[model samples]
Target chain A: MSTGRKYLLQNVAPYGGERTTVLLADGVIAAIGTDVTDDDATIIDGRGLVLLPGLVDLHTHLREPGREDAETIRTGTRAAALGGFTAVHAMANTTPTQDTAGVVEQVWSLGREAGWADVHPIGAVTVGLEGERLAELGAMAESKAQVRVFSDDGKCVHDPVLMRRALEYVKAFDGVVAQHAQEPRLTEGAQMHEGIVSAELGLAGWPAVAEEAIIARDVLLAEHVGSRLHVCHLSTAGSVEIIRWAKSRGIDVTAEVTPHHLILTDELARGYDPTFKVNPPLRTQRDVEAVRAGLADGTIDIVATDHAPHTREDKDCEWAAAAFGMTGLETALSVVQETMVDTGRLTWADVARVLSETPARIGRVSDHGRPIAVGEPANLVLVDPAARRVINPDEQATKSGNSPFRGRDLSGCVVATFLRGRATVMGGASCDEDVVARA
Target chain B: MKHLLSTGSLSHKQAVRILDTAGQMAATQAREIKKLPTLRGRTVVNLFFEDSTRTRISFETAAKRLSADVINFSAKGSSVSKGESLKDTALTLQAMGADAVVIRHHASGAPHTLAHSGWTNGAVINAGDGTHQHPTQALLDAYTLRRHLTGGGDPSGRDLAGLRVAIVGDVLHSRVARSNVQLLHTLGADVTLVAPPTLLPVGVEAWPAEVSYHLDEVIDTKPDAIMMLRVQRERMSSSGGGFFPSPLEYTRGYGLDARRLAAMPDHAIVLHPGPMNRGLEISADAADSPRAVIVEQVANGVAVRMAVLYLLLSGNESNETKVDA
Candidate 1:
């Protein structure tokens, strides 16, 4: 762990509750309530700030150890801190593919050296994400990173026997296989969502059944094997229905929705802008409404950033030619607040549950997603709920300018972020600039 | 209009104005000189990211006949691997001071991206985009239909209010079908799309055109015109050959044959945006028939493209035609 500093937060609402004083020292919540005083602490007047446990992302692409031109652990974690995330599960689809224990540990160590957020490296389920044979899941789970999550995110593990074997095998290590639900043959040359918009746009349609079919098949497979199954980036309405049905059947499946899907729709693709182009491409407004309702209820368990970053060269061309992703780490919280909180679909406490607590619980992170009590780890974020800012991708810490939310005004801002009593971000920017730069 | 990207966005007034301008441009082509100085000193770039010698030469001939400088830039490959090439090519065209860019790309929406990207100030004309829109092709087809079906050969200020047109074959991948369905509907013509179920898009019912699975059914109706789309054999292998069972089976189902040709009205014209698959989508008897306007469609394509270049480059769009054809 990096060296931490003492801090005093005065009159901040924990989980948007009554204002109270909290003290941090020795990388833990040393004291709380009135009379919590420390002379050697940096005093913060947190008026009108809603404090909550720091956000933990179940899905984030650091793009480190490869594709550093887009993002690295250092930049990605800094962006996470700015977005109020204290921990992030880096996806397995990197250059060399984070399948082995050595690679996951390397990524974990890079996150430690960055010191912005605690990086949990997710191991790949398939070797090189090829889906031909399983990777060393047992070894990676036992490694230093202790990867409990295994996934072939960019490519789906389509082979039923392989998926079944993976589902059955990961149970030995209490690991969950996060599936990127896509049927390859059904989505051949798919550019965007298969709908009226795609019909007119002339781009090949990515039918909802393509995702639903795999999700349906995998959920049944998971049930038959009786192992943990996690679905990534559930976009379509039919997908929500399937997951709801799976959950109703008491199947051990948990699903996540991205920030982009909550508000943006396939109508955005009418402009043919590649920035809106994503895998499991943005669905219609009806799908958007369905996902919002799903998340509002407990049907969708968590909200993951899926914070993919791509350089301008990848996104500045025709829709068919562009890469499939958007940068989300920086604007994730603000988007959640605008879509979930401000819309009355969720409260601040629910925000903490979906964005921080639930994700941490799902990822089996013990230190994070803890209550703001005395002697707990001080991984926290102070957000000004009334504050708002237009998202500018250039101003983001991530090296990519492919933010789909660029130029849109979003509510709430991270006033400060604390990672174990250390201010990774203060005054809406990275704290300890010189120290961070050197580290 | 700043750009002719898609016919779906074209208003009735804009569509007619273009057809009228094309009619005047067609009259000019009848002259012995067959040249115009309307777009003189203008630089028109024929940017072909997909190789279509027919489209490139047609655009080239149109630009040259208008006395505009035409530069052909062909960068052929999958747009997926040629992502940066499109942007780089656009920037290069911007640097070269192109006044109008006639683009034909393998990727759908490539022309839309170019027109709105702020990379160049040129007016973009879609020669054809990936199964998306070929606005000029649709325009020339409308011009052809109007000349033969409407107000004799001098169809000015008239739209095909009640003309029935049946567009056959590969509606799923034909940029021609997509563009024509929209433009024809805008011009008040009823369009029936006849194709195999596998060859039609999922949401094609939402389009303005009515759909038919039987070519003989549409041919039995004695539509004013039948436009046969090019059926690429590569689609057979690429789409798992699931689009149809065999060439003979497809011809038996949707092909415009000699018997189907004889069933049509005597005045009903035949249209094909060629390099025709003579024995595939259309047989030789139908393609070479006296009623077929396939060759005339090519000559009209030049006039239609010239009108587009003239209207766009002459700064006289959204107004009456000012040139004497």
Candidate 2:
């Protein structure tokens, strides 16, 4: 946020090909197309780059106000910047849970103070994410953070009445309640996805019907109440079919598919590797195909990095005792490129829509996920789609090194990312060179 | 074999070697001076993270007869109950310089973790682990089979080729059933798994065994041996383990009763890896019948475990190698 400084990005491919020049000035896209030059502007040679609006993550776990031993607004946002995200929706599951306006504002202010990525504190739909009682929703919606998304992500709001009431409550302020759809009874001592691998591995099964059943109930509830419902991390194929059917019947529902779900499967659970252990668990190949089809079509709305971070001690133990979730912020785009774009299923334009525009709309963040045009916010990333790198968790920026795709060679790399025209990342490294003065 | 984790991966030659060596150990047990100086200075620690007095005692006796110092670390009243983890316990034992660590855990792959994790330099022996494998139990079962089926032959370096064995009851939760199926298959035996539809695991069809729902059908095909697995009556719940109607119903369907026992081949033996459910999975009449080797299997367990400890700790080589060295 240098007020009047200009930046001239030379010869970059904007979304759908055709080499073009883009210029940023006064925190807005000053110009696009031929002969875009400014004398005083810092010139960046963006040859062999595909420019996209900086990614907007609807699901991010900034373990602040609580588990700073795992992550913080500073480190989490810095990791986000490296992943080409300009804004992220901070999940509500924290130490005290982000249930009150006081905690939400504190988290939001901390994100602003870090000045790396904009953190929108998601208000918890229930106190402590317990799913028993309603949290302070209206106050959070109107607070300084202006929280528009609410969720009890780590735990599912299993009670039909509770889920429906939360959905209806969020409707009052035009907010969407993101539901982590998992039936508690169906997953009591659940260790991993219930299937052939779980049986062979002797790990307890987390059945797919448990997730699908909850989604089936919640979608009907959302329809009956005429409120917005966002399903967080729809992992199974049956879940896709349910969401597809719900959309066909015209229910107000939007769903996200995590990057890991698109590429990984439950078969990886064979070695008892805790790195592959995650909530909603990696599923079968058929489910992977179904979710891919769902995303390829518009059945799935966006790809959100449910970027959960944990301490090494929390994840490097026995499979049954290991904490669930994979560190995802750094690998989201590359995985998407490997699974979707490189497969010729989605275009660069569609990539921006899913990763940027659609997520910004869902989280209701006006400053982010905007198109790169003259006079729009300069929140974007420069990508080299041909560049490939083998993932090494030791080299990633996230605090937790529990990346399931550690040995995987993924396509594409983010070369530079601009957060509101300020270079938060340059040359694949975090640049804290300049930003607006702290409040 | 530095570690005896499972018999599923045991080769035909390896299975024969273990059975032959177990016969030699069993021969020593009958002597008035039933002891050896083979593992004279070695220490064997029986680490039981699960309560299995039957398995621990068998290993303790085996280690003692071989002149190995024995130590029992039961989890019930130990530091394990004081929030001590498996890693800490393994480290403590490794520091004590135990030669062989016989582990029985409630977790399926705990011994596998301990063996492959560089936790210790000594040999690892899996007494039993949760629904995964009981290698020594399978070894003892195989030894019993060789003794009864060999029919006066020396039985050295020979496989149970063409031997048809049927494993009955609760195959879903029985580590004995899993290990026996694998070892019996590798030893050139055709293994059939008979259980109620609910009592079979999701991936049992992929196993190296014929899956059948009718125990009556398997009894009709009875060629050599029928091993009965224990069905935990406590696991007879609705939400979790597996579905079994009632003890009476299971006894009626899958249980080995006197009438079924009488119809077996004259040489065909009835084996139950004891702490048997007596009348539930197997009737008392069948368990006590002359054909039943439940008690003998217990005695053979000590002998088989002695061979496993000897083979695994002494480079898995032949007794000839030891003599030449």
Candidate 3:
């Protein structure tokens, strides 16, 4: 496919600023201003719409190569596009485990072939996410997919020595080890957040210290080895405190808060519905307030969609037997808008930074999270922040209908998503044709 | 009142009603023929996912005495993976048109899940679900307490008001203790839970009860009743790094002995939710003493369960008659 078509967006506010027309051609922003011409170009009426860089998810599970019953590259990326995400880092905890270069390449190419959002497959820090030995981290980094983020997401790298070594080893390739910080012994049979609710519910407790302890240890390990460490789904107030302390100490550490953790709490687990069940299970309302504060203060660097999808059989039964994840790709921006921007806690520019710039910088995804300016790649999303709707899982593009935000009113809608100067989503739906059929 | 899942949510009025109904059921049990015509054409399924012969037999005997056709569906060792079997078992019971399903699962909240998941339309009676709840057991314990300490022979419409109950041993893993604390408190009794600090859950302070680590101190208070919870020794080691050091050590700290039993008030009773760990949580001398009412607790269990089943099933669907024989 050739980038021959010229399209112009008229009167769109960039970063919620003054409205101006932006012209796109040759897979880049050609011009931005009133001088931008619509002659011989398709015009999109973007009056009153806010434009930002396409959302970048540092943590997403496009459960491909295995668990395709839940999601695939074609559908997950399409869902991401509909959510205004032009790039997502697919997590490493697959059946085959994306620990090898071949699997990462396969996933990256599959994303390319899908013609939706750019998919960057995260390499597993350990073999099969077993936490025993290191995977081919160097090989994955050097592969065609160029994986720079390694993680054992579903399982934590519990062995201190292994964690230390993985952190050090990734540094050689300028890579960062994304850790799922859970102390295994502390979280054994843990059904939900360890608090008054879990005690009343009679389910086993997953204590907040289980996550915070590991984060404390890993941040120290990262400092000792002079390497970068990324904490995945920081869910506890203690974790926020620990990360804040580590940053103050000048330790190279970055932390992400999931959209679910920012809004939902352990109170939802009272119904024993698995729809609310998630690993690093929802914490207390205090933890929710802490994470919101963390995100606002920049102690938490980004908001990543842990876009885990599971089939009906996986979540149809009792809470104890159900899978621990919630499909999040389609509702991420709306949730961010509802919790952060609409609450007057953050500006639209901060939203772009947290949801786009910071996450891209963390994942080392250079192509995305760029500013919507001239000569930059036209990877952008047009958002109608005033629009609100109740999320229905049935209408989502992901294969799994396990969205936890179902039946809740959320603000902001992705009116359109452009990946590299071409429309991946137009009119809030996936553009059926390929944006550019990559060779 | 559609389901008897947990006494935690049961109101004071509802608790008295169940105890009052059990008094009527207990009166009928004294007759030569205990069978009643209240549930003559109804069907009750004892859906025991976890093996509890005592609980199953009590539910079965209760259902039969009420003239409900009983089906003992002991689905123990069914696959717990994804709870396919729990749902499958419920659907099977639903297909059989069982009027009420008595469920005991190894996982906490399984009965609540079954009741709310819409797998079956029948009323769910939680027999025992992990360490979460055992409402009938608490009801029976309260009934026994009411009979001994409150209403004398016929504790009809009587609550255990102003009676102090000390629940001792393994408060962390004891569904009996969890159920009793809430039910006893709801019935207007002051409940003091006595256990080693390790045997108490993290959020025990929030429960509507007092917590004490020393059993002798609680015994010194001269409580009206001391309910000894069974210590599942297997759970001690298996549930994440041993909750206690040894049985001897646990006995020394929280066990009810002959001396402690003698320290109780003259009319006080010693109750144990059996199958008891004889020399561990309770001594032989105390368990066999005249003050001990362990055996009568079993008899009262049937009456309490009968009261729960009758209230849940006989309320709105009594007009529809079905005969199995």
Candidate 4:
């Protein structure tokens, strides 16, 4: 058995008691107490720093295999670690996607080799993400990959029977189906969030009810099957009510709100910049506040970075021609800190709960979302909560530089991240060279 | 001259300048020999990706009036339907020694793409893009509105100040509505958008126009012009059921029928970017009524487009020469 190097973080705030020293050995926290005398141990000062459990993301599009130029397992995982995330549920909307055990296992193995962050490969609920028929859910679940989440994320599973069957089938294996929640028929040629701006701009409007209707139906289907369902990036105020009603009825449903969805609104679409374009598009400020309130009150359970990356060719044209997605992994934590924490809607503890703890619990990742203590897995982050900086997409570590938050000033920054006693990021920068060398 | 894509960006002064120039063009149309030598050396291409008879011919007429050689490129009989890409067609047009390409594509921003894509160095005019701004349509509508409401007193030189306009119906699918809203606002008209909530695009609060669920509320404000948008049935298939519930329900709630037409102020005119759903958006009686100005809007379209072409192409000659020098 290899004994991991011991390091102590003294005076970690808001979680472990003041002046507590956390000791790590063999990937787990070995001790936490007032004093521990070890002459050979390396002690690091941690005063005025908040020790947070490693973040987990339920939605991240790691464009791999075919579209590696946009994002790869190596670059995207490094981005995740830099954003304070220790594990991310890699979406199955890749080229030759995670629709089968073979593909899922390949992505899983690539993530293991990358070794920057834990990549939990999400299997596609339908073959080719076509929304026509179910993929080999059981095979993916039982394979060496062990994908417990099934999703047709980029495309909506619009067929009711197919949705119901997927909902019912996933119950057998205790797997939760995460839905992208858009009615394709209603949103055909839909460019932006359907509202006054769409009317004014004369772009095709994508109605909120298109998304709300899907969530309403899926939540009811999950309730009927007595299964768990995770709603991905709930955007509208109407969606909040549906999810609130679902949770009130104890339907075993959890919802996630994206960092972009919580902060950005449809007003940005007026400029016709493709960077603002996204799926379940940015809605009104009323919807933004509702989503924030949802996050605060637990109506929304997680802050998933729907970190979709698109090539510049896909996004640099007219508003209608641009692909729907924006790079979110690197900016997710800062946005949450700005929109939720600095605004008094949530504290650092709430930020930790939403960004890290709740998402890990929802995805059923056991080693993740552990408390920062002895005997716990040393997956953690150090945050500089008072740090203020402007977002520069060119400076982001993600392969794609399509962040709409580019050039906007944001509060708070992630200083370092430790994944299983490994410092994957330090001093607000990704330790990519070391990880690549290790890999 | 580049094609007028969407009126959403035209200022009052710019709109007036275009309309005044169109008035000058209209004077030429009235002459026995209706042609000009200004664009005799230029070639104009009418690239219609969607079905259109009135818009295409108006553009063709406008080009001929300017004495430009006109090439009609309809998508139905062309290689576009066979998937011979837009770039290929542009190259083909370029090979034919085409000077300016006037393209009306079903895809929004298609003309903008063609112009900026270096597909052709010739001036590109947007006939229309998918539910996006139609600059010429808004200009002509403004011209017609100015002529009817202002009684031909050179309303071209002035913005629609002290004017209140209510735009009704299918705001979501109507590029005309989008262009009119922006152009009218820029020209100083207080605009209101009246449609079913489903017909309004997603984020409407940020729009300059006030949104109302009913047209009666808009009429209560006694608008200067009540522009009715044609409700394309294809939008129903895309938007799903209950877009208006029924044509009868739409007529009752939002349509500018004879009864609703009577409710408008006598000075207020009815505008439509034609091929009107006669029984749906407006009654046959109301459409032909003296207050309609629907036919006049069409006549104004040719003149306005002529002015846009002449100004954009001719007005930039000095700048082009400077660059060449």
Candidate 5:
């Protein structure tokens, strides 16, 4: 392990400022912009590297405890580290269903033992994801994992009563209810985003209103109950507008747009390929512009990679029958760089705040998304901002190859990722860490 | 064509070829023996992931009439844990050496998946897939419409040029409605989609058709034909804020009853892709009427499917000369 060893990162620029030297030692930042006197310490050449706080994914589906064929904490966090994420909130939709305190603790521990990244468990809002009754929210909130986020991702909390109650219950422990905002009845048998493309393709349409309506309702409910509400994977322009309006009114609401949603649109579904099929399906270019404007203006709070992983069977099939997500952990940063930073829609400082600080705040992961200062934990990533590469699925870190952005040339390759001073990834290669064997 | 996934993409020339070929297949069915030696050595598979006895039998008959070996595999009950059934089923069909796979799945784009996934070297014919499309059904409907309009002749070079078609009821969830609207438009027909404001999709205005809520107004237009789409009871509580008050209300407003049928043009016809709802979308009186042509649509389904199978599988690879023992 690279822990306990001093390192000098020379002439690297952090997201907000000019180039400066950052010293890492004893699992924390020893100094920034100062010459160190450790003669035996390592020296890392960061002349051309752009450093950012380690990416924190508020939404990730590390399919563990069951369905490990797709992804596990060990591989998933490694992929996360490759994408420059030091912490990821594992969603509650697992085989046993991460609804209880016990399940969340197990997932949290698995991530800890993996030693690649910190994995905070998101408790399920409803038991078994049935949406009929509430899960033990208080128990999960007080569990060993200290799950501060609760969501029934993949399945929407459709019932107004259930949604309001979930929003209310989570507020007691300062937990935020991350809602997958979709109206179930409207989206029944829905294949893709309802629009001109769906009309032409003849596939059943998942209208933008299905997501917007729920968000409109939830924001009101959150205000009524005086609680914080987080919207997951906000896709449509109408959704962004509603969230913006709610935020303007001072409703305790924050919204996130996934990296896939930021760049991709519904036109990709023209080929009838299942790879493009996702929940809150991709919308039109007009909606895409609206979301981009929303993100640039800070109406949308953060960039989340609803990083769902599915096996080939789950994705390489009919669009309607396919699973509803893309593997985003390894490709999120590149996507953001191409769509946001490269487009001049957002700066590296904006990227830092959205990808790390804001998400960590939403998930209540205080330890992961800290500033690049002396005495702070060394959770950071080094990016060759000028480098570009076409994404190859075979070279991906995820077990699944369903990267929706396959073959697209994207810039900003992650060269190294450090989790509390230990380099999980160094120079684009994984550093060998003594991961605990399965007990 | 490698696949007949949807009528949405089928060109006017290709559609006319299928129709003209069906004219020949329909002639074969009128003969004493419907069997042919054209596909004697070929193998065709009917991979149905959805339960549709009518469509399954129609395709099976189409392949058998051409003397091709047929394999009927129903993957109805399998381990559908995250859509593995489709992949496993597709791989099995690939290994079975089936020359063509006629697939009918509940999901909207299964045939497109089967064709483009490269799981098989065979051709793909979409029988019906979710609410997305049913190209064969549209072909048969077009075949029936053309035959009824101008008396049985070669529609090889013809399009439904001056024909006006009104597709009534549940346009939101009806694959039949979607496929017909596209195919009919491509054939140079003017289509008016008649539905409750709720039944039509949000972006129907973008489709190559005009929309109307009143069936009587559509009937008053004296259209060349009125095609009634099947209305599902489940869609009432869902799609568009409760589409209708009740089944009776829907039948009264849009149902093709005797009065509405009488309002159509004298030479006009009525088409329904069944199993019919009895008195729901179309009344029993109208369905049993001589002008209905619903039965003829079923009979033409076989012929259209035969034409699709023949065109897909009867390339130069066929022996073309086989002895009848």
Candidate 6:
């Protein structure tokens, strides 16, 4: 539908390069070789930039049609794009959630209208996310929206029989059920991760086994059903072990870790700030390292932003009274850079793989997470890995101001983001004009 | 900031601040017109899914005293009894314009689920969940301890440093014990749990505090306070054990009888997470003793909850305003 010549960076090395150029035409990278002359081509310098495949998020909570005060599709997608993502799977935990074909279509249409990132609406595994009855999974998978991911994300699909059925049912469409694995009985009164911190804090303990138990059961179920199961926001070391064992057995199970879980520990709960409160509540330092090791050793498949947003009122309370989520969209990459890259735990290529390529493949997003090569769609990001900035919630794009990283200094800045050869973010600021034009 | 849910997430500093602020709230309770305009424009909904007398009243009284509009929604005889789900009830509350919800349910993680499930934008405060943690109860108990043990100086400004507390009786089913153990430990108090093996919950060794089987042995340690938990008779029917030979035997051994009371240091106080089984766990004399702060604990519950609410909600706002200025 459109044709234009755009050069990204010329003579850039593949993984570690200081300067490079990529020429784009008709939404794909036209060339990547040394300087070529084109009369009407736009030239953009890509010096000191590492171009990555457009990022993909397997777990994102785009709260829309309900709790719009916290976030909406337009705002959430804009945040995702600014964070260098080209595709994101919208979690099916909204009010009047995406459990049916109708709801899935509504979310898909909204994403299409927004035109920022490719939004794949995840259908709810259970009706109303109650975990009692199966939703119309077949109909949702076959809908115009073409749902490929089903999840009771905010709540675990705890019933063994129901989980098995949901896993087996999605096989027809090659869909995956992203499970929020927590055993209900084990975490009955749990307010935070159960450990020494929980005991000292006197909060009800949410044991790691609660999450581990379900992961073990579901991974076994996935093997039995011969279907794909994606573990959502795996929090503990024990969960990492279960996922590792599942992967070793060649079970079709993939696990994701949130940026917060990789960086934070339950010791933050000692401050009694509710911003630290989260589902699959934050774990100990040992668990934090285990998640890092999991991410490094390939036990964890992807780094997904469980970009859960909650209002100030939801989080500004006594530790026990407050809500259990913090805004992550704007901070995920910065955290990953700080915790993983800065610490020398992962290379830039590893970052591109975990944050983008692998996630897109897992969610089956065709247009995104492509290698930054000729003929591939120009869904890409240019990052300045050395830039450092302190997190300010007030400056974030999300409507919610419940970020836990407030005032913490983080490195790595997303200089530019391109979705389908169109610049969504340039010079480290979102292209408001382009976004408005897309809308 | 909105409501006191469980004691688990509180830090020593935050717990101390709540207790200190509670002291000021307690001072207000003695005033002629005991109400503040802090939360005047806010609407607090008390949604009790389980039957409760003291906890409900404490929250209601706290909200009213803070000048917040209060809505009482009890599950008994309400639409909840007609099989309406928690989600439906939350939606109804949201429609009714609730700013905060104070919920008590028989299910342990129901409030946590409601708060995190995106069902409503309103803040959620767990009043009590099944065998979870009762945060405000711990707050009041901490407040009571500070007042009696820490002298006229505000105990809230500091942690419960150097204080030794012994909690005796049913730990298995008592949410009160769970909360107190957490809050007291955070406040730097040395806590000892005294309960029979049958009465203690599994995995208690994982707890931060010490566990003892004999109250007499615990009394020899000369604790700053001895909190006697009410042994719920209902649990006896469920567990199917003569937990003691009888109630009389419990009174003779673990109960805060006069002899055990005498064994305590002169300044050691008596505490009970009340609806006190007066003669069963504590004698009338001990309950009414000058050193007993049981009633004071109940009165302090309101002030402590008010402090928790004030610190969590208003403190952040004030801090932000200062930062802006």
Please tell me which predicted candidate would have the highest lDDT against the true structure: 1
Candidate 2, superposed: residue stretches over 4 Å from native: A1-4, A433-439, B77-84, B150-152, B238-242, B316-325
lDDT of 5 by residue, A324-345 (tens): 8888998899988888889999
TM-score, chain B, each candidate:
0.95, 0.94, 0.94, 0.92, 0.94, 0.92
Residue B311 lDDT (model 6)? 61
lDDT of 1 by residue, B160-241 (tens): 9999999999999999999999999999999999999999998898999999999998888989999999999887777564
| TM-score per candidate | 0.97, 0.94, 0.97, 0.82, 0.92, 0.72
Q: Flag the better candidate by lDDT, 3 or 5.
A: 3
Q: Which stretches of candidate 6 lie over 4 Å from their true place?
A: A1-5, A10-14, A17-19, A36-39, A433-439, B1-165, B170-191, B196-209, B213-225, B230-275, B283-325
Model 6 RMSD to the real structure?
8.5
Writing each residue's lDDT as its tens digit, candidate 3 over A1-439 gives 3367778999999999999999988888999997688687889999989999999999999999998999999899999999999999999988789999999999999999988889999999999998888999999999999999999999999999999999889888889999999999998898999878887778889999999999999999999999999999999999999999999999999999999999999999878889999998999889999999999999999999899999998888877888999989889989999999999999999999999999899888898999888999989999999998899999999999999988999998999998888888888878865443451
Q: For model 2, which pairs clash?
A: A54-A380
Higher-lDDT candidate among 2 and 3? 3
lDDT of each: 0.90, 0.86, 0.89, 0.82, 0.86, 0.81
lDDT of 6 by residue, A1-439 (tens): 2335364554444454545567777788877766654556666666666788878998888889798999999888888888888888999999898999998999998888887787899999999999999999999989988999999987899999999999999888889999998888777656888766665445677888889888999999999989999999999988888888888899988889999999999888866677899998998899999999999989998999899888876765446656778888778888888988889888888998899988888888888888878899988887878788898988888788888899999888887777788777778888875443463
- Candidate 2 residue lDDT tens string, B151-211: 6667777778888899998887888988888888888889998989888877677788898
Task: Decide which is better by TM-score, 1 or 6.
Answer: 1
lDDT of 2 by residue, A209-237 (tens): 99999999999999999999999999998
DockQ ranking from best to worst? Answer: 1, 3, 5, 2, 4, 6
What does fnat come to for each candidate?
Answer: 0.77, 0.22, 0.48, 0.49, 0.68, 0.05
Better of 1 and 3 by DockQ: 1
Worst 10 residues of 2 chain B by lDDT: B316-325
lDDT of 3 by residue, B1-325 (tens): 3788888878887888888888889999999988899998899999988789998999999999999999999888755564788888899899999889999988888998898888999888889998799989998999899989995666677788899999998888778888898889988999999988878888888999999988889889999999998888785677556888888888888888888888899999999989988998899999999999999999999998888888887766442221100
Better by TM-score, candidate 2 or 1? 1
Higher-ranked by TM-score: 4 or 6: 4
Candidate 1 docks at the CAPRI level of medium
Native contact fraction (fnat) of model 2: 0.22
Q: Cα deviation in Å at residue B26, candidate 2? A: 2.5
Task: Report the lDDT tens digits of candidate 4 across residue range A303-409.
Answer: 99999998876775656667899988888988988888888888778888898898888777888998776688888887777788999989888989899888899
